[model samples]
Target: MSKRIQVTFTKEQWSMIEKFRGILGESDAELIRNIVLIWLSEKSIITTKIKKEMDDENGNRN
Candidate 1:
């Protein structure tokens, strides 16, 4: 299952995000998803399976 979210950012913050998005070649959704997944992984809130899946999606291996 998936959930939708609404986020509000200041103009400067949005500009930064836009800049990084362009440089990283990521769409808004992909950038936000990767950010959230990274946070979850850092906080140890995601399962090993999810971590593996995320790593695989990012073409990373450990």
Candidate 2:
């Protein structure tokens, strides 16, 4: 039901996460999750879902 991913941040990146988490009151994992989701949402797996529905309606193969 859930996945745990491990990441190794560079010194500068770890510092940034600490700074970000301090303000957000979240762990580094939560902070990274939000950041990545926001980025992915702009060009994400959702696109495949949308395309699938459209093709189903139009009977087109892709």
TM-score of 1: 0.53
Give me candidate 2's TM-score against the actual structure: 0.55
TM-score of each: 0.53, 0.55
User: Could you give the C-alpha RMSD of every candidate to the true structure, in order shown?
Assistant: 4.6, 7.6
Per-candidate total of colliding backbone pairs: 0, 0
For residues 1-62, what per-residue lDDT tens digits would candidate 2 score against the true structure? 58998888899987877776755558777888876766776768558788689788899877
For each candidate, the alpha-carbon lDDT, in order, equals 0.80, 0.76
Write candidate 1's Cα lDDT for 1-62 as tens digits. 68888898899987877876855458887777777777887899998998799899899988
The lDDT of model 1 is 0.80
- lDDT for 35 in candidate 1 is 70
**lDDT, residue 34, model 2:** 75
